[model samples]
Target chain A: MSTSSTPPAPPPSNRISGTAISKEIRAELAVECSSIKSTVTPGLAVILVGSRPDSLAYVRMKKKACAEVGIDSFGYDYPETVTQQELIDKVNELNADPKVHGILVQLPLPNHIVENLVTSAVHPDKDVDGLHPLNCAKLVTAQTHGGSVKMNWKDLKSIPFHIACTPQGCIELLDRSGVEIEGKRAVVIGRSNLVGMPVSLLLNHRNATITIVHSRTIDAQSVVRTADIVIAAVGRAKMVKSDWLKEGAVVIDVGINSVDAPDTKKGYRLVGDVDFDECEGKCEKITPVPGGVGPMTIAMLLRNTVNSAKRVCGI
Target chain B: MSTSSTPPAPPPSNRISGTAISKEIRAELAVECSSIKSTVTPGLAVILVGSRPDSLAYVRMKKKACAEVGIDSFGYDYPETVTQQELIDKVNELNADPKVHGILVQLPLPNHIVENLVTSAVHPDKDVDGLHPLNCAKLVTAQTHGGSVKMNWKDLKSIPFHIACTPQGCIELLDRSGVEIEGKRAVVIGRSNLVGMPVSLLLNHRNATITIVHSRTIDAQSVVRTADIVIAAVGRAKMVKSDWLKEGAVVIDVGINSVDAPDTKKGYRLVGDVDFDECEGKCEKITPVPGGVGPMTIAMLLRNTVNSAKRVCGI
Candidate 1:
């Protein structure tokens, strides 16, 4: 008769918050940065074009993160009308600068300026975003060429170059949270070069059975349901439902979608590809929309800058 | 009941042969070569550092294949004592030669010479093997940048670069044979940069659900059995058996393993990764050893040389 008196235990929280994990990484990076030579701080050069509000915000956040880690941040703000050659010239100059260890050009450059041309201009050694063809090629070939059969975030130190930040962040979160990826089924939605494609490759490198479901993928839900790990990057808001997930599936929501929220003071709110409310209890672990992968991106960029600097110093 | 003797219909032969397909492609190339401006023919430079019988035989075959397609062949034979710098100098020399439209450094170079350094020295524009880091990066990002979402061999022209010959050859054989790859389940065994890794990425570009089973993959057979198509590139001999395939799976065996055959004149016979005897009648389609994948590789290399020459001449 007294059994009803026992209060229902609060639903155990399995939220894998990227904010906390990123803080841990940033703290570790700060210690590493300090332990390195005090004479020269790791330098990160960023070139931002066409003052898009979001891109500016992202660039600002990255610079601030660099400062927090005791790294030198150099900024080059250019007008939207900057010629491709001029941008390439700036990149080449940065490439030759002894002070700069890593270089990143804020993405979504002016339509006239080809993204690939601008991104590849960054020296492969200093390409913190890992977009340069040589770096990309190295990432592709590294697994088969003297690298580990399975990739883990801890193993990133052994890799000679930068990895795409967002994907690296996604993996870092999963890895830090103690989720086992080896021998697991991983489904990556979307196949964009920046996120889906590279993450899939990284997962494959980690010995996961990977399935990439894109725009043309048939039965996307059924395919996703088979995964132990699900990475949604289709830029769709709350598209993944409870049914799409298997019991105890770990979810890494990479898509950041803005949706109308009448009740909010701002009139809008950011949501992820997975419906967080439905998935919170169902999933073994899930990342939140605003506080999850969003913060880790900048943290990874800082780590890449430090690593790039370490390489130059032959540490 | 009267018993009438009837011959069992030999299991419908669904074997996809590479020799016949290569001959067809070479014939087409020969015709194209004759129709093009004949003043300056396409030329291929091959640098062989050692006289390993297999390497020499491979170089000779490549040279002979080039001749059949009206391409000029330039050979550079060096002793095993050659230094890495000497090999690199030779590559650089050929790279600057206007007559050399494509350059291939025969693989398994002298122990002292690094394969990647030599392979990368072949100017990317003329890297016929597509082993250069830039070319490998281009292959990785090609789809995300300008190429189609789902890649097929026919779309190779739009990529504006040469793909790894062996992997491209596998896809070409499958495509030309009228096998549909769209939305199919594909399992690629092995993750070698030259074959398994690139082919898996190619199949993913073609909208197939790709599962790559490498040395670290657990329960490899069960993982492979779910595929509608399986590509076996692990160098092991006869590792893929009938049980490893789905009932109607299309198999592309890229592995070429030499096994001792006491009765054979050479005392050894070439076999693919699949146990063809058990698979010949069990699967819907399968490529055979010796005549499968082997010839197609040389044919694709010839195609690449011609394409490179065309690019230089802006044909």
Candidate 2:
């Protein structure tokens, strides 16, 4: 009677493994890529300005991913001194290239290069990054029209218009994990166009009541605690605490921040906006930083490229 | 208590009079319209597909407003038997005509006619109603870029792109009333493309945190109660009760619903989403139905027409 059986053997961790899911998606994309290659070879043109180490690493990873999925990757590297007009000209050249199904411009361009002008220069059909104004507008229109339309995400081959990679990845993670988005309260902790805003729109399209809390938000913690699904993309390292989340909330961490670490080989460690260690057991399903949204982003990008190829080839 | 003092006079009702503000705006627009007319006549083409009484009444009101602002109004009347192709053909003709600076297709076309196809047929530059996909996309792009750019709504001559009229009207009301939008909690009920979604984006661009609650929202009342600014656009009469609001919240009621009113010869009266009588003293400022939002919408449309004329005429 006195034996207290190890506190009922605490329930298993509910961590959502984006790495495994992304692997599966990449395998599927590989098959789709090969099939599409028969009619038209899928190609992605990645434009990188200035050799920021991090940006270079991201580009390499993307190129590697494209190769893995059997898609063609073309790299266009520019010097730091390149003019904005030069960049726009390159984008226009890529836009006219029928072989280039998807064009991606690496972000954080040099100060002199106006980002929006360069990004907008890409043709909407080939703008796989989905930052083009037309694509964003289409996303907004989808939200209103999607209210009555029942979309089967499982059967989804390609959205006619491209969506931003990270946000699309976040949704893919949620959907593949068997999470029900309809009627859920989803709190997005940033409002960046690339991630936060688009992701919130995607969630709303799926029928999730959304609350967008930003830097100016008052009592952000309380607002977050009310969410059934929490998407943290504010770029703050470990800013979210266990107490800030409701018990069993689904957490998707999109932030990747580098923090100093004396013991690490790289002299720093990468952490997400969420405090993973503290939030582990509290969450019903949570994505780990490096292995979570990072891999999925690349996967979605590959998918977009393949989709664009199919559309261009009339598959 | 000394002298049995009467409870301090209830603070004066802070009604944000959209009617008065709209009149003021219309006057300003009239001046602008005349100035633009010096170079080229500003014309708005109102397309009426069917003979629905309400649609006819709205069309007439718009035409009257255009006249009041000294802009030319052209009517295109078609019976209910009009085909979608004919409407598109007419819109294309108006799009090509320099005289038609703005083209508006009155909504609620016959069931057979696709609404989006007809509305999208108008060129973006002449889409005074601002329902064009390109215009909606521009509005979204503005939100992302507007973060660092300080826009003076007071001195705003014309937005480079057209925004949905009702949403722009809501913002105009708030700015004119001097209700602080930045750093406020805004709750938008409904997520309609015409009013709710765009207005929420407008508020977010102004630095307010936004929460969108739709019909599927759980505990919608509590979510709304947290708002400092409540925009009720759900189109349900008297749905937002006084108790569902934060004390001293600013309310913009966008719903115009008809309710039974036996005393009136019309047999019905127009009401907004917010319960006016119960919410009057509770709100710090609130817009009234019939006189609020409604007039401002018409005013915004005329302003858009004049703006389009100025752009087209290169004035």
In terms of lDDT, the best-performing candidate is 2
Residue-wise lDDT of candidate 2 within B95-181, one digit each (tens)? 999889899999988888878888888999999898987788766656333222344434334467787899999999999999988
Residue-level error in angstroms, candidate 2, position A79: 3.4
Those runs of model 2 whose alpha carbons end farther than 4 Å from true positions after fitting are A1-11, A35-37, A81-93, A96-98, A143-158, B1-11, B35-37, B143-158, B312-315
lDDT of each: 0.87, 0.88
Q: What is the TM-score of each candidate against the true structure?
A: 0.94, 0.90
DockQ of each: 0.48, 0.49
TM-score (chain B) for candidate 1 is: 0.93
Q: Candidate 1 at A161: error in angstroms?
A: 0.6
Identify the candidate with maximal DockQ.
2
Q: Where is model 1 more than 4 Å wrong at Cα?
A: A1-11, A143-153, B1-12, B143-153
Worst 10 residues of 2 chain B by lDDT: B143-152
Which lDDT tens digits does candidate 2 get at residues A1-315? 788667787666588888999999999999988776668889999999889998999999999999998989999999999998999899999999988999999999988877888888899889888888777887787632222234443333556778888999999999999999988999999988789999998898888999999998889999999999999999999999999999999999999999999998989999999999999889999999889998988998888999999988888
Q: Clashing pairs in model 1?
A: B150-B205, B151-B205
